[model samples]
Target chain A: MIKLKEALVIAEAALKMARIRQLNPMSVAVLDARGCLVAFQMEDGSSLLREDIAKAKGLSALALGMGTRALVGRAKHHPAFFVGLSALSKGNMIPVPGGVLIRSPLDAAIVGAVGVSGDLPDHDEACAIAGIEATTYSWDAGADPS
Target chain B: MIKLKEALVIAEAALKMARIRQLNPMSVAVLDARGCLVAFQMEDGSSLLREDIAKAKGLSALALGMGTRALVGRAKHHPAFFVGLSALSKGNMIPVPGGVLIRSPLDAAIVGAVGVSGDLPDHDEACAIAGIEATTYSWDAGADPS
Candidate 1:
């Protein structure tokens, strides 16, 4: 398992790459292939809760093997489903911004994911997107990490 | 900062007090005085995602300054409102079952939270309830940690 250091490096670089210096302090979490946390980091001044948000976002993306953004539309069609999952998981099935599927060049398996918070959805998503770009994973071939 | 160890102790004690001995592997998460992770424990054979789920629940409760149950009503009234939040936080908000705000004494300023996931919602809730009963804290009546 590649440690989350790679993802955190990407997340931090994305913060700078996205010019997020003026944004609210942020938090980012990375999960392993098994969906366990590989690494978690909170930027200075971030809301303490930013962490939970990040992890939930990442898990949502990972479990469904889809970007949380797309999950929103699915939830729209099946509100109860996501709602039920939200309850089942106790509320971490957010289908929103700031989550991305990570993949690797070798075999193109999804390495993990990155979830971001402490800013607007768009900005938060922007950081995550930037984070992906910082990784070695090929974003063009998006697929679930098995 | 009360380690998640204390929180885990509470969680396990809660389960024992409730007499739940492995309906499913359970995950427990505790946050600190500053709302960071005190500790996170996922029982073996639990869902691969249990630890994240558990911690994320606790994180949601503390971040929102409400119980996971309260979010259920909020989610009902404004399902659409949470969509954006899901995006912003990146999908880590559970509003039901076995999630709580870990707080200080007296005014109950939130110090942290505990999230439990594994069994039925009621059973999970029982674990969290047991944890709180066993955990103790000290705070100046009117003081806020933040």
Candidate 2:
């Protein structure tokens, strides 16, 4: 279980990194494995839909058991499947780079995930990694290890 | 227009009130008059459904142009109408307290609405009121102003 304290920590760290990197104002969402929202924050000046995008990214990571980054290629190769999945998930499956899966360092168990928005996709993904790295938990951004 | 800064302040104030009153962990959502999410936070211990409930309450108030408190009686009297409204809104019209409309003190024009969940309905409404009162803006909890 991803405790609330850790989720808050992850969210705060992500926001802090965004500031330090001079990225655009951002929205971040942390969700437990069941895709339940644990904590969320949207920075001032962020566009209205940023919150929904952030949550959708996180939900996509959880639903597919992979970071949204990995889903991007699959989505491109199988547009029909991606479209069906999006509909099935009620538009929560956003295959993008900012969604990252959180895992336990000890056994690599899925714990939770983080989604970020308001910056370039690479920058958003970087912020997510920075937040996860601030703790003992491991993260997968869905890039191939090799 | 409800600035994101004010929205964040309202959400934080509501959460602080919930803690002070020893209410259950709560989720708070702030929405602009357009019913777009501006700021939201779900306390760690809150149930998974609390965020949805919070947003729905705020949307309900905005959709009906009244606080959710005022809708309860009307909903009870016109169950079919309320049901249809809920369906039309994609299940966002929850006719209950805790959804308070935020108004500008100058002209009483609605700026936005705040919704809180995870406690007794009355307590939730109180927290929403406290949050709105913390700002210069006014609020309507849908009670008759007799």
Candidate 3:
């Protein structure tokens, strides 16, 4: 289970890495297994939109059972369906990089997802990966979902 | 100026107050001034709906710049307009008794909002109020707006 405290630590770690790398101000969001917000942090200089984007990205990762980076190709192929999903989720389906699924390192069971925003897409994704690594949890990049 | 750590404290306090009162499982949400979620927590037994309700309540309070309880009377009077607002917000408007605006105690400037759900309306409101009181910020029950 992705405890709330663990989620908070992951998000904080992600933002810290962002700062350490001198990336633009960033926001991080963590969602529970049920796709509900657990904890979130917005750096003081981050734009307000970063908060929503991070949340949407995390929710999308949870709903699709894949990382946001992987969703990009699928979304591009099924643009209409993806747009419909955004409407259904009330604009929460953000199919972009920076969202990654978090799993228990021991068993590989999904725990939750973490999303980072407010920097270049790849940089945001890197921060999310770093955050997941900081925790005992492992990240599922959706490479081989067997 | 409400940081994520403070927001988490408020939400956790609201849930704790609910437990102390022996109320039903509850979910609490805190949103920053820009109307983005700062923290959220759902009790172990809370229904899934509680999460959505708590967030909608906080978002409504932020969008209207008043407590949800205060919005109830106005919503009753202008039912059509209020309904329209729900659509505009993609169903985030929840004019109920459990949402309260948070203001800086010293300056009373709007800082954020807290929302609680999954118990009796009055009980939820009480929990929200208690949580706000537990913090340094003041609760805006929509009195003395000036």
Report per-prediction Cα RMSD to one decimal.
11.2, 2.3, 3.8
Could you give candidate 3's per-residue lDDT for residues B27-142 as a string of tens digits? Answer: 88888888777777766656668878988888888888888888877888889999899999999998778989999988888998888898887799898888888888999755
lDDT of 2 at B91: 94
True contacts kept of each: 0.19, 0.49, 0.42
Q: What docking grade applies to model 2?
A: medium
Interface RMSD values, listed in order for every candidate: 5.8, 2.5, 2.5
Assess chain B of each prediction and give its TM-score.
0.81, 0.96, 0.93
lDDT ranking, high to low: 2, 3, 1
Model 1 residue runs over 4 Å out of place are A18-21, A140-146, B1-146
The local distance difference test score of each candidate is: 0.67, 0.88, 0.82
What TM-score does candidate 2 reach? 0.90
What would you estimate as the lDDT of candidate 2?
A: 0.88
Model 1, A21-68: lDDT tens per residue?
577777777776667887777776454567777888787778777777
Number of the top TM-score candidate: 2
Candidate 3 scores a chain A TM-score of 0.92
Model 2, range A51-70, lDDT digits (tens) per residue? 88999999989998999899
